[model samples]
Target: MKINWAEDLRERVHDLAESLGNLFVEGFHYLALFAIGGITAWASVMAFLGMVEKGHISVDDILLLFIYLELGAMVGIYFKTNHMPVRFLIYVAITALTRLLISDVSHHNGPGMGVIYVSAAILLLALSILVVRYASSQFPSEVSAKPRTRRHLVIAQNRAEGDPGES
Candidate 1:
């Protein structure tokens, strides 16, 4: 069998271009994540302080803080795992929608707009959860599937080699 060097070279060049494009896109995503994270962290801190100063750290304010915490955690998770959990974003959206509904309940003239909005938010959250559940059921997390430590790998290798006594 003869290997086509020219075809292989062309394929390699195409692969390199695709990889570079992906890298550029990922870099932009990271930058956007950091920017949004910084802004949310600052806003959360300020809002928390404002609530404290006003002596009104209500349930809604606490929920807002939870949203902020989730946002920060989402950012941290992105940095650690290079992937953001859609679940967190859905939670944030649900909280935001709830907060809006609560704050505007008194002034809303419509009959079921608040209910509709809240229901929509709940539906979105449920859909996100379902998608994540389905994806994970199909492709479980690496943490559950494989040992991440070198020591664990060494132990497994020793066990495979028939060294039962090695602790």
Candidate 2:
């Protein structure tokens, strides 16, 4: 059997192009993550310096640091698992809202419309996080917690294995 030169060349070029594209995408992903890590570190350091200069750690400072911490954790999670969990974003939102509410109530003479709105936002974020957790446990598209994602997937597909939805 004679190998077709044109077909062989076409297949080789296609494979090379695909591999090059993958390498470029991976490189860009790492570059973005590196920038994010650097920015997060810089912000954390600035916040720490501010706290030190003030000689007292306030709720606002603590909340800012928490947001920075969550951002760093998010970047790390993406770098490690290649999946960004929505729960972390919700957590950050809740923290930021709480920080806003604290600042508004403390700085103002009384609670205003902003306080009510921020409180509502925070409550909604908390509820969202709970709903996501429940859904993840119940529906379980992937076995992600403890047992293993593959096992969870199998369990979800097999009813005799004790379905989470049934229980």
Candidate 3:
């Protein structure tokens, strides 16, 4: 019987390299998400403080806050599920366009072509969100479409084997 030492060493090396690569990618994701989350929080605080100093919340101010909220929610959902909800982005865009429309109207004292264009854009974005939601619901992906972390796999296994342990 021949023991292939060279092949064994090569296989070990490949696996070690792959593990290290995965570790690095995971660490990078954590760092980036933390930074983004922290920035969103800080910006929200600053915006709130600005509104307080101004002594009144304008339409634009409220809309800006809504944008921040949507951003925070997006970051949180991505952190928890690792799935970026496209609807959140569409919500942000809608909020931003509404803000712009409000700003334009207030500045111009009346609606203009810009208002029409912005309104149309917002409507399109809303329709796109509806389409996305309908498509996701009507054509759900395979179970494997979602990335299964070790924790999720363990929970699934527990449920499958009737362990009744931590799910």
Candidate 4:
């Protein structure tokens, strides 16, 4: 195969562009985190004011507040740990679905769609939790099963040494 310098240069340029694009995507992820934080804070404050003005906080409003709180917590955890909890996202989705159901049930029409939507959301939450649980169990945070302590190792060695004689 004849080496084409021009083609090689074109490929290198393409790779550089791709690398820059990936960097931009990561930057946007951080930007989204900030945007989410701002929006959640604003919504929480507005909800609090609405509660004060109404003199009564409905259950739906309380649920919405919880969703916002979960969102804020998720964002905070991401900021601190550089990762968000899937469980928290599932909880938020479930709570939002419940809030929607509560808000819609009292209306005279189309409760079926609300019920179906809520049911789907609950199913998705359940599946997500199951997946996370399975993944955590399969691939635990601890990389090894070995004990790190010299004392434990000595004890295990002694136990192994004595096993043949005892048997």
Clashing pairs in 4: none
After superposing candidate 3 on the true structure, give the runs of residues whose Cα lies further than 4 Å from its correct spot. Answer: 1-3, 143-167
Native-referenced Cα lDDT, model 3? 0.88
Estimate TM-scores for all models: 0.60, 0.78, 0.81, 0.60
lDDT of 1 by residue, 1-167 (tens): 25698866776687677667878988998899889899989999899899989987777788789889989999989877876787888888888877777666645756586678677877878788889889989998666543234445667898999996447
What lDDT score belongs to each candidate, Candidate 1 first? 0.79, 0.84, 0.88, 0.81
Which residues of candidate 1, in runs, are more than 4 Å off?
1-29, 106-113, 140-167
lDDT by residue (1-167, candidate 2, tens digit) is 25698876876687677667878988999999999999999989998998999999989999999999999999999999777789999999999888888888888869778888888888888999999999988997763544333333555777765555422
Selected candidate, larger lDDT, 3 vs 4: 3
Candidate 2: stretches off by over 4 Å? 1-3, 141-167
Per-model tally of clashing residue pairs: 0, 1, 0, 0
lDDT of 1: 0.79
- Locate the minimum summed-lDDT window of 10 residues in model 2: 143-152
Score candidate 4 by TM-score against the native.
0.60
Relative to the true structure, candidate 1 has a C-alpha RMSD (angstroms) of 8.3
Assess candidate 3 and give its TM-score to the true structure. Answer: 0.81
| Candidate 3 lDDT tens digits, 38-155 | 9999999999999999999999999998999999999999888777899999999999999999999998998778888999999999999999999999998664555445555677
Question: Which number leads on TM-score?
Answer: 3
Ordered from best to worst lDDT, the candidate numbers read: 3, 2, 4, 1
Q: If ranked by TM-score, best first, what sequence of candidates would result?
A: 3, 2, 1, 4
lDDT of 2: 0.84
